[model samples]
Structure formats: structure tokens, C-alpha cells
Target: MEIPRRLPSQLPLILYLFFIILHTNVATTDTIKVGDWKEILNDTLVQDLGMYAVLRYNNSTGSNLSFYAVFEAQAQTVAGLNFRLALQALDADFPRLYKAYVWEKPWENFKNLTSFEPVLG
Candidate 1:
């Protein structure tokens, strides 16, 4: 069998490129898949978080908003867990839609309202 003179020189470059491609794909896959939001079926925890979000917002803004019901919820895990909720509330006797982001560390008994904003049409 005859060996090509350039084969040895090209082998290292091919292996190096293959490894680089593999590493790049693994990293991208991890980053994209980590912390994906998942739907939460209605439960006690979801209800509590929904109420907590409204209560915190009302307290901070001094707005007389009352917690009504949570329409939908999703959760994501990060350093802590994040609760995203679409909830209904009463503002001056009219129902309104709200989006709330709550971050909670259950082990530490720590919870914070990250964002609360009314959803517009």
C-alpha cells in the first residue's frame, strides 16, 4: 500500500477540528436546554405564589389591587426557582390581567417579586 506524503500532516488538523466542533455543540446544547420554562398544573404552590405576587405589588405600589385567580403558570429553575404567572386581579372593581415573575428559595424561605406588570390587550 502506498501512503500519501500529506496524510500525516493533515491528520492532526482533522482531529483538532473534530474535537472543536464536538465541544462547541455540547456547550451550545447545554446552554439552550438549561433552565427551560415548564408549565405548572394548578396547585397550592402556584396559588400561593400568585397571591404573594399580587400582595407584594400592592404593598410596594400602594395600589388597591386584589388577588383574584391564577389563569396559567410556568416555572424555571435557576440559582433559585422562578415562577411566572398569568393571574387575574381586581383593580377598582374591574378584572385585569397581570404577569408576575417571582423568584423563590424554598429551603431558605426567601421569596421576591421580580416583576409585575399588567398585560395589555
Candidate 2:
């Protein structure tokens, strides 16, 4: 089997477009904002979850909303004990599109955390 000679010609153009799109986040994309967490509601005697989060969705329709009460995990005697929660929606007043996500990890692993792109929007 031989590789298509034409495939190489399009490789550079493909990569260039990929990066350009990233630099300029096209419209219709939602952004996530993290809030402060305080007071653990679900205490396990080992880990206390603090709920102080809100997801704000900017709407082109001027019906923006915020989802209150997020998630936070704090632990002792553990090196990696943390997590994040986010709520995403296509628009403020629409019900056809929305998403919720959670990511957990240790404090030391934050450096290796994935970069932001699009979670639910």
C-alpha cells in the first residue's frame, strides 16, 4: 500500500485552519465561569464538599441565566483531591441544548489538566 501523494499537500492547510479557528472562537459558543466554594454539604468525615459555584450563560437574546450551587471537594491526608463542575447551555431561553460535566483530580495534577475548549456548548 502507498500513501496518497495529494494527502501531504493538504496537511499544512488543514493544520493552519485548525489553529486559526481556535484563536478566533466562532460565535454561538458558550463560555464557563467558576465561582467560589464554601461550606461542605456532603461531609464524609474524610472529604468535605463545598458548594459555591455558578454557571453564567451569556445570551444573544438577553435572557442570560446563572446556575447556582456548584461542587468542590477538599480533603486532608490526600495529595490529589479536587474536582470541578460546569453547566452549559446553547442559549438562555432554549431547552433543546444543555450540558453538565464534572472533572475530578488531585491538587498536584492540576498542571496536567486539560485545556478549555467546549464542554457542553
Candidate 3:
């Protein structure tokens, strides 16, 4: 079989691009405990500024979350659930997500798609 003359020249560029993509996605997740949170949450959020209005306390579930560790875990779990929910909501834009929902082959890298739906709720 005859090979294209340009194939050899493009090989290095292809390999370079592959390595660039691989290295760019290599990120480490750091888990910070609630006790160490004083440093992280210091004056960053709006709530840190002033004394907010008194929130009504309704003691329903026994999980008071008085211990910050419990609060952190609950917060992380809610955030993770919200992320998955957002992903599912994205699928809803395509077609009947409630009917024949599709679980696609997930990609490691992020993708961009645009959709618009009028807000009713």
C-alpha cells in the first residue's frame, strides 16, 4: 500500500495533541474537613458579611446538623445530587426524557450544547 508523504509530518502533531489533552484533564481532588473550613469560608460569601434575618427553626428530622461535619456531609450529598439532576435536566431538552431515557456512554471531558425551554414552574 502506498502511504501519503504528509502522514509522517502529521504524526508528531497528533501525538503532541494527545499528550496535551491527557495532561490537561489530570486534576487532583482535595477533601477538606469542616474544622479546617474556617479558613476556606472566611468572608468569601455574602452571609459572612452581616447578621442575616433570623431563620425559622422547624425541628422535624432529628438530624440537627449542629456538628459542622454532619452539615458538610449533607451539603456535599445535596450538591452531588443537584449535579446529577442538572445532567438529567440537560437530557430533557432533547426529547421525551421521562419515557425512553437514554444513558449515554459518558465522556471524561466536558461538552457544550445549547437548548432553550420556556419556564413554567
Candidate 4:
């Protein structure tokens, strides 16, 4: 007697099992952590009036990064002095992000003029 061959339904089941195994193997493999904001910003373009600094940390579970920037301009007269500061935060993949900008008014006794969301370049 001849043996019966597997039906088309078996093909989908076999493919599903193969994908499950492949995904499991990929998930179990060790993942290297890339957490260095200083290095990341070293290659970035710096603005003429702005200076930037970054701090980063990571562990086996996850990572966090923060960036700070201070922009200053000198004015010969009281009207020309202006200051702007920007701060940003991001995750390892940079999917989740936050940014803030602050303006300083020294004429008004060096008080914070306003705070707003920074526009991304």
C-alpha cells in the first residue's frame, strides 16, 4: 500500500512552527547595549552660538540619555543681549523623545523669559 502525502493545511502549520522557533532564537540571543551620548554628540554639528553636552546610562534591562545645550550671545548694548537654552531627552532607540527651550532676559533682572517646545532640525 502507498503512504498518503500531507495536505496543504500542514504547510501553514509547518511554516508557523518554523517562524516561532526562529523568533524565539532571535529573542533569546544576547543584546549588546549602546549607551554613550558623549560619543554620539561628538560627531554632531554644533551651532555657532550653542554648546552641547550629553549624559547616558544603561543596564541589562534598558538605557536612558539626556542632552543639554546652552546658547549665549553678547550684546554691546542692553537690547542685544539674549540667551536661549535647550534640553532634550531620548531613549536608546530614540523613539520616545522630549525637548524644552528656555529664554533668559537679563535686562529684566536675569529672569526666565519663557519656556517652549524646541523645534527639531
Off by over 4 Å in 2: 1-4, 26-28, 36-121
lDDT of 2 at 62: 42
Tell me the tens digit of each residue's lDDT in model 2 across 12-67.
Answer: 99999998897688553543224433233434421211111222223222444443
Candidate 3 C-alpha lDDT tens digits along 1-121: 9866997899999999999887777544355443232122323221211111001111232212121110111111221111111111122233111111111122433211122122233
Please give the distance, in angstroms, between residue 22's alpha carbon in candidate 4 and its true position after superposition.
0.7
Error of 4 at 112 (Å): 39
How far in Å is the alpha carbon of 100 misplaced in model 2? 28
User: Residue 43 error for model 4, in Å?
Assistant: 30
Highest TM-score: give the candidate number.
1
Ranking by TM-score: 1, 4, 3, 2
- Candidates 1 and 3 compared by lDDT, better number: 1
Question: What is the lDDT, from 0 to 100, of the residue 94 in candidate 2?
Answer: 47
Cα displacement (angstroms), candidate 2, residue 32, comes to 3.2
Model 3 has how many clashing residue pairs?
A: 0
User: After aligning candidate 4 to the native by TM-score, how far in Å is the CA of 117 from where it should be?
Assistant: 29
Global fold similarity of model 3 (TM-score) = 0.24
Estimate the overall C-alpha local distance difference test score of candidate 3.
0.25
Query: Could you tell me which residue pairs clash in candidate 4?
Result: none
Q: Write the per-residue lDDT of candidate 4 for residues 8-91, one digit (tens) a residue.
A: 869999999999999999999854333212111222333322322222122222444534443322212224333333444454
The lDDT, on a scale of 0 to 1, for candidate 2 is: 0.35
The model with the greater lDDT, 1 or 2, is: 1
lDDT of 4: 0.39
Residue 15 shift from truth in candidate 3, angstroms: 0.4
